[model samples]
Target: MPAPFRIYNTLSRTIEDFAPVKDGHVGIYVCGMTVYDHIHVGHARAMVVFDAFVRYLRHREWDVTFVRNFTDVDDKIIKRANEVGKDPVALAGEFIGHFHDDVGALGLANPDHEPKVSETIDGIQAMIGNLVNSGHAYEQDGTVWYSVESFPEYGKLSGQKVEELRSPDEVPGKRAPADFALWKAVKPGEPAWDSPWGPGRPGWHIECSAMSLGDIGETLDIHGGGLDLVFPHHENEIAQSEAANGKKYVNYWMHNGLLTMTSGQKMGKSLGNVINVRDALSQFPAESLRLYYLQSHYRSPLPWGPEALPEALAMLGRLYEARENAEAMGGSEPVEQVISGLGEDAKKVFELGQGFTSRMYGALDSDFSTAQALGYLFELARAVNRLANHKKAKKRGGPVVAPALAAFASVAETLGLMAMSSADFMAEVKEKRLAAMGVSHDAVEQLLTDRRQARADKDWGRADEIRNQLDEMNIVVMDRADGSDWKVRLVAAN
Candidate 1:
């Protein structure tokens, strides 16, 4: 049986139990990129949030059909193609490939269906035809425009009254200031398609309406997008879809908050302060980026700073180290018996481990509180670390820590954290961070060789000196009981 969960609906502005359009199934459509450039960290947050939500719903046995679209035909793509002296379709295809690379590196699952405006032209035109036939829209000089005044519920979703709205100046053929274009007449040097009205392209908002209705039916269980799109984008979608279908557009609306810079401005491509996902992945492991996104409530405006990824890397390292310590523990006895012998630390680990799943589910089910879920994981880590400090832990505490060990495994399977082996994770951190810092591998290897000789010759002073030099270079040398190992330290440069 699927678990019951509640989500914060933007339309209702309240948390309510999710009742699907069809029992045991959810149809979700999220607004995807415009495909004009590489995706950035802010964009990745929306991607990861929706991806994780879908993963959780599927994990809980809910049948979910996730649809995310690509705006391959848009003003941005056209302008960018013109600037680069390339066909707009070809330029969009280039950025679409880059989008896949960036999101794939961030470990996002592919949507169940990824529709595009270029491919969904027929559907878009068909929807516009319906609106025009139903008298909800009209054509002027080959352009189709939706009469926003015809929909009495225009402000229902956005809570903005038409009279109160400051609509843009009337365009040449639009009937009213608020009547948005359903289809734009063909423009020079742009992608075009045949339609009953004329040869034209889909408008920005109408594409989503057409694609969602065509892919998942007239009403979606949940329609999601960034908060910034609530006004003109989502509001327009509601008008077009409802007017055409003569039914509800979406049962629930979900909007994620934008990532804000430290200066309080939003990180957007238009803002020119965006950090590209490709650049971020080149500097840090994908998990570090994932951690940075999941550390906050999905609906809260997350602050991006010089220390964002570094802080997240530190948090991820803590969880991995705790898991490693738990895995290293050893014992052969009943858990209760071992706990009784090992005292309070063992008992704490045992109790917290037993309750870990419940706490995780509580956080996840209640508005997908990733921050709270991680708090519980950190609590488990602390318990494990405390138990590992016991002198007998390595040889005689495995049975006691078994549940704690299982907790980490569950986290890996469920949340996609601490999924890599310690050695592999550290190696990836070194390679990515050092490469990002422009450090040469051969130079570091020679320094390590010199340090090894000093240690072999019992020149402890010389060995320490070389280690300090490497430290200054942002390298950390770990003198293990077996030998010396080195890694590039991940921290905020600023």
Candidate 2:
């Protein structure tokens, strides 16, 4: 049987039961990047949030058709192309390639349909034509404007009054302050297509409505974007889509919160404060970035600081340590017997492990609460760690931790965390951290050789001094029973 779930709908401003347009299925549309430049951590947050939501839904057996559209034709792309002396279309294509690489590195699953605005020009024109014929739009000069008054529910999604908005520079052809363009007439040296109105390009907001309806029909189960889009961009989409189709545009509106800098301002390309995903991934594991984004509620403004990645790496290491400890246990006794012998801590582990799946589903099913879901995961990790401290755990505790192992695996399959093996994750950490710290393997090995000789000669004073020097360089040297292991420390520099 398919499980029932509830999602917080931005359209209704309430948490409601999610009854899809079709049984056992979901249709989700997310506004994708404009592709004028490389994707930043701010953009990656929305991408990862929706990607994990889709993965969780499918893990619970719901059939999902995810559609995200790219605004290949946009004012920003045109402006950027002009400044760089490149063709607008060619520039968009190049950034789209870069987008795929970054998202692939972050381990996001590709959407079922990645519609591009340039390719869906026919659908956009058809929708514009319908709007004009229905008296919801009119052509002035060469531009088509969507009449705000034509759609009675214009403010339903955004809750902003048309009369309250302040217009930027107004063109003479627009009928009202709130009305936005449906089609922009072709300009010299710009991309355009032949249309009934004129040779023109689709407007930014109209392109999404057209491509969404063209791919997923008149109504979508969910339409998602950053909170910044909820006002002009998404509000305009609701107007154009409903005015043309005479039906509800989207059943649910989902908006991910924006990323704010330490200064409390939202990151944007125009602000010159954006950090590209390529730059961040170059210094940290992809999962570290994923964890940083998933640590908060999708709709809450997440703060970015210099220590964010280092803190996330620390948290990720804790989870990995718990998994490694669980995997090291060995036992065949029945769970009940082991718990009975081991007492409170063992019983806690067993109980938490048994109920983990339900707790995880409960958190995810309620408004996609990744924060709460992660809290439960941390609780499970504590239980695992407590059980591992048992004297008999190494040789006789595997059966006791069996359910906990399954819980970790379920997290990997559902949330895309802890999917990498311990060895692989450690290796990635070493490679990335070494590069960021500018420390080489050969240099570290020579330092370790001297330290080993100092210890062998019982020169405790010299050995301690060498360890402090490596510590200052953000390297940790571990003296295991058989050998010494040194690694790049994940903590931030003081």
Q: Which candidate gets the maximum TM-score versus the true structure? A: 2
Candidate topping lDDT: 2
**Each prediction's Cα lDDT score?**
0.89, 0.91
For candidate 2, list the clashing residue pairs, or say none. Answer: none
Q: State the weakest 10-residue window (summed lDDT) of model 1.
A: 410-419
Over the stretch 134-253, how does candidate 1's per-residue lDDT look in tens digits?
988999988999999998889777898878888768699988888889899998888788889878888899999989988899999999999999998999999999888888999989
Model 2 lDDT tens row, 293-370: 888999999999899999999999999999999999988988888878888888898889889999999999999999
TM-score against truth, every candidate:
0.97, 0.98
lDDT of 1 at 403: 79
Candidate 2, run of 10 with poorest lDDT: 162-171
